[model samples]
Target chain A: MTAAPRPAPVAIDDPADPRLAPYTAMRERDLVGRAGRFIVEGEVTLRVMLSARARFGLESVLLAPERLAGLAEALARLPGDVPVYTATKPVMSAITGFPIHRGVLGVGLRGTEAPGAPLPGLPPALAPALVVGLVGLTNHDNVGGLFRNAAAFGADAVLLDAGTCDPLYRKAIRVSAGAALIVPFRQLADADAILAFAARHALEPLALSPGGGETLAALLPPARTLLLLGSEGPGLPPDLMERLRTVRIPMAPEFDSLNVATAGAIALHHLSRSA
Target chain B: MTAAPRPAPVAIDDPADPRLAPYTAMRERDLVGRAGRFIVEGEVTLRVMLSARARFGLESVLLAPERLAGLAEALARLPGDVPVYTATKPVMSAITGFPIHRGVLGVGLRGTEAPGAPLPGLPPALAPALVVGLVGLTNHDNVGGLFRNAAAFGADAVLLDAGTCDPLYRKAIRVSAGAALIVPFRQLADADAILAFAARHALEPLALSPGGGETLAALLPPARTLLLLGSEGPGLPPDLMERLRTVRIPMAPEFDSLNVATAGAIALHHLSRSA
Candidate 1:
């Protein structure tokens, strides 16, 4: 393959520069939510965003001058219109309000073409698919971990209920090892809406519950299956539980429960292996 | 069964009292390492520590008065010599360097009797057992999550290399949801020791690698399998990889990798179910 031409890095020294606004006061803004755009941190995630340009549009990139050389190949792949800003470590830290250890960040616009829709398409091997429907999962770490597991086990997509945390949140994206960027996901109107979507798609909805259901080993998931999971505690609401086929990972007698992410991983592994 | 009589809680009005040394300077001391004693937080872990009395001996209990009534049963079960100290919320926070929102804590000694040894014995159902052997896994969260998954899938034990973080660290204990307290585990002398132990016990050593080995779906673990996991990024050291039967969780193309804990959970779930 021919190498793409290297673009000259645009230097930004002033932390207060208007072009660098997105990099400032990150922690406080992260709390209020990302509004429309989301910050992608670390080199691995930045590369994922670059590769996923068609899905998540790159706004721009801010990196330490030293990292610019290392990311040249990825930077070359970014769209010509996207600007690449380089600054010293101190300048980057001043703008970010913390050390940008990996010294790379990409701001990307959320995918718009398939807004509020499940993945438009999946690879043939990933089909006869397994998908996760998350309800009331407010924890970002769990959300990220679940997406990572979903991607690892060949689950086609993840469907998040309204109460779920933003998959694009920086921490979630980082924790997911950029699976949030790669795995197909969309927010739904509510838990009921997820159930309806599964029904319409002919995807059998299986609710994962701590209370005993069919042992995972005995059950053979259909061609298309939707494994529903709830928040760590309180679990799937009673009303929702009554509506779907419940399945449980038979755990040891007295253990409270596995981490939601770990539980999701086990379930996905089972469904994927069976498929 | 007749109920055992409850032990009266000792009240402490001052956070700085000499008796509260374990509660004070916790964050700093935690960083320095817990000199054989570790903090168990929240109700679930405290209960686990109490039940594991033979493995982890309780040093003391600190609680808010409101929680005392609820824990009467557990307190009655605690050994007669273990002290129970109650303090108001403010005093508890002052002692702990943060809000004791759970209103409870238990200090326990690391089980010394079985140091560097595999779990002595396990129940019949869990016998054809699966155990996790961790190498160079410094992340405490991953350590705790692995223990929790091990417990859920009925794994008999967790064997950690010396490079691994202490499973009894407060964050690990909390993340494990107290599994670190309940699961039998010990720090091995080194990676070589873990491999030797697995061999001596007739435990099949299967190393989990991202570089793609035998697909998990196509492989069945032997009677006593040791699922070996390493730190997420560097993965199992090349030298160690050459020594064990390497296996990989088949993942989607181009995605980074699953979290180490999630990978362990999937592997453990597979071995346990297959058994």
Candidate 2:
């Protein structure tokens, strides 16, 4: 089927326009279970989202009026029901919490699905995909970077533990450079269920530690893998460590460990390529 | 020689005490070119410094009185002339521009040139070592993470090319968890010089790219190798790519590239183990 006709352009001159409420309110909203959405800003992430076919039901596209002419062709290609909101730079900044660096922002509905149904219909061959589990990683920037890396390195999905921060948090979304939306992910239950599920799927679970058995390269698992990582200071809890194979990225004689997200990326990259 | 006696302890009730000047003006003070002067905060990093046998020409050690009482035994063990400044939490925070989460801060002289000197004394069999090159990475956190990873993955040294950020920035030092101090590194003139130096040392230089010729596993050079990394947004520059053997970490379809520091960790982990 041909794509839907482009959305009608809606000009927004006043920053206080009532139609822009949801977009503006996004800045201070709790966002955990909110039906409204977060924004994906800048050209690169915007392009990534469009190409991924993840933005099929866009709520509205906001842009600075002066830059609207530059994005006209791309704007013309979006689905018809998606309204395009044009605002001055100052108004857009006021609506969002920060300066509008990318000149484009896509407001989308928050997505929800049962944690168990991360991927709907993939067969067993794709069954035991590489999933990176994040536990207690509170830094939004780090979480965002991890998602970006996960998307870049091709982790099948990201599973966040109970204490982990919301992936849709504005800072997290911006930090992921919008990759959080594109990457297949779910906020799973606690670490126990995550480990049990991996075990059930025959996915070898490996916990990254500074002082683990074999170096990551030496213990590249034969089956699908789950690279489990924890926050910076207090690494994987001893209880969790008891459930999985502990592996480390070997370092020089003096250094201790890499940053949590960096370590995660390395482990994900290794698992992606080896599998 | 017997270790110098630990410096006398001093107590200051006021945040504005003149003796607390260096600690207070740390961020505002330009640190480059200063000999034997650097800041270390937090217990873990402080422990790392103490254990590394880093020269203890410490200018001052600032601690909250509560922390001081707990660490008094350890403080008593320090060598001569190392001054300890005790203050209340507010005074400590006021002096350092933030709460001292580690509850301890040490201003020590930056070590002189002994560590950075060429390893000319080693036998021919051990002449060459693995060196990791970082190019155009300006983020302090990234730089800090790179150093920490470099040290963990047994990289002998980190070579910084022009356009890179200072590895000694305060944020970098803290983020590195203080491994930045322990890892032997030097800033180089240009990428060309680094390439030439690697060639001279019989070190194989592998430039990382998202779509390089071979997977990192297949293309890692012999034991003596150098892994080159670029900034997060752009991979290696075209000229540097032309000068070195290129390799890629095979990633999943639709993913872009891993973060520069994460990529470095993976490469270092892979190459070091195989070597």
Q: Can you give the TM-score per candidate against the true fold? A: 0.89, 0.84
lDDT of 2 by residue, B1-275 (tens): 96666665788988888888778765665444244467777776666666634433466788877786677666765656667888877778888776655668887676556655674222244455678888888888789888888778767778788778877666787777777776767778878877876776777788888867778877645767778888877768986787667888777566665667777777787777754
Reference-based lDDT, each prediction:
0.83, 0.72
Indicate the docking level reached by candidate 2.
Answer: medium
Model 1 RMSD in angstroms:
3.4
TM-score of 2: 0.84
Distance (Å) between predicted and true CA of A272, model 1?
Answer: 2.1
Model 2 chain A lDDT-worst window of ten? A118-127
TM-score of predicted structure 2, chain A: 0.88
lDDT of 1 by residue, A121-229 (tens): 4434435878899999999999998988887877888889999999999999998888888778878889998989887777889999887468776788778898999
Compared with the real two-chain complex, what DockQ does model 1 have? 0.70
Question: Cα miss at A187, model 2 (Å)?
Answer: 2.4
